[model samples]
Target: MGMDNKMIVSSSPHIRSIESIQSVMTDVLIALFPVALMAVLLFGYQALITMVISVATAMLVEALWLRKRDIYNDGSAAVTGLLFAMVLPPSPPWWLVVVGSAAAIIIGKQVFGGIGYNIFNPALVGRAVVLVSWGGYMAGNIWSPPQPFAFGADVAAVTGATALADQGEAIQYKLSDFFIGNVPGCLGETSALALLIGGIWLYYRGHIDWRIPGGYIGTVFIMGAVFGGGFYDNHLMTGLFHVLAGGVMLGALYMATDMVTTPVTPAGRLIFGIGCGLITMLIRLWGVLPEGVTYAILLMNAVTPIIDNFTVPKQFGGVNKSA
Candidate 1:
């Protein structure tokens, strides 16, 4: 018995910290505080109700699926549920949210063999499903935030204005509002400040690979400048809005960082980030949809295997004879 006990003890990925799945997931949720608060302030009870319903539905679906598979527990479902809730708009119906969550856990994740085996980010898959199925509802003209959650009804009501609706005139917005997250958009994506805080926290904890975010944001900025058409006004900020206003921050920070879906090699990660950025830009600028981050990430998810094959580290003393 003593010998067996000694054999059972082991060490050596030697770094240790007081973090667990619950702790990390809780931290992520906590980090989302600013955005969640901002979202409730801007959107209202409708958005809040939708988020609650969506997350609850996600958890239920995950539990049911796991029970079916005979696997006891996994925290991924909770993460997926919360992420799905965050990306939805203020007005999406509850049924759509439920269906999207189901699809995320079933088709996008479990079918591919669950958690570490999945090839794509499940939350984005769910968001993409809803976006495709309910285009008009997802992108509506009435995007005013809820007054009850916001400090002042008058202030929340001001978010009703949007730039994309107009043909020639530009919609002006205060940078402070955008930063602080008082603008009109998805539940969690409204506040750049909150997203940045969360992202910084994730980075500090070493739970994420910073290369992916750095590459994605950098590519968007550079491409925005190249295609901006003008020098100062229309170029960078518009692209930045595309980055800031939708699921880009959430995807870049959380979804894109998923170890299973992303490339293993550093170079492969760079490729993945660049591809995500390009596709997002194309969809926003040229495609019919106003937002493209979710689809862009999923599309790149499919191509990660190819990127990894080409960029993975070489074996010792390996030689390239094909040249």
Candidate 2:
């Protein structure tokens, strides 16, 4: 046989798609457009400013770290920055945004060796840092109400608690408000409608797995319906409220589904999602914080390797360890 006809076997991953990291990250950014647009429409220019600063800081930090002139390296830094902004208050101090974005790219990402090597989601790491360091700004009754296309409006003037805040037996806003994202919350987390649209786009592109989101949202709904007090109309509605409110939609569809940090095995992915939901509900119900999506995902991220090890399927005709 000719040399050209001979088999040229290489290591694993012989079958690879044409996709690159830049392409994958670009798709994520496109999917997040609706969430970003909704943030601006709901919270006005302040949200836009927050996104700009965060994205700029993240890209700048990564560029400087790698000693590369290309600020948009693989586009992962931009995604991390935008996601970090999504978890933030609509109008947090500019300095805080810069610090958190930088932290996300540095400590959360590069410190672990960058992108696919990082164990935790960079955006959540940044948010967790800010939340711990500046709890007053990140939590409490500081959420700004949406202005609904009032681009020039000052949202900060009318601050209030989110629907998820522990306020006894009555939800403050209508279910419609939560679905439409008119209620006060984090910049991108308010609008379930927007997130659903983005999720659909990601799904269509085959960028995400339904098992993770399904298991996560299903667990949250079940736990909410069972344990959540019948605060809003009925237990069913309360469960639905849990699904639509705060970062449940965002975390389930986006953060928890991160390709790099999450597991590769299907079973591991499902378990990861369920674990995230369980921890999030546990924190929201019993922990000190009103929101728990960030920490829940981070904690699950730490155990991803263990989950994958046990969940990986045995190869065909492979011998059993006990045998």
Give the TM-scores of the predictions, in the order they appear. Answer: 0.83, 0.93
Predicted candidate 1 versus true structure: per-residue lDDT over 230-259, tens digit per residue: 332576776665555556777787777776
lDDT of 2 by residue, 1-323 (tens): 48668788899988989899999899999999999999999999999999999999999999999999989979999999999999999999999999999999998999999879999999999998898899899875778878899988888888888777745412778889988999889999999999999999999989998888998999999988998886778999888888888899999999999999999988889999999999989988888888889999999999999988888766689766321
**TM-score (C-alpha, index-matched) for candidate 1:** 0.83
Misplaced by over 4 Å in model 1 are: 1-24, 68-72, 145-170, 231-234, 314-323
lDDT for 101 in candidate 1 is 86
* Each model's Cα RMSD: 4.0, 2.9
Highest TM-score, which number? 2
**Structure candidate 2, residue pairs in collision:** none
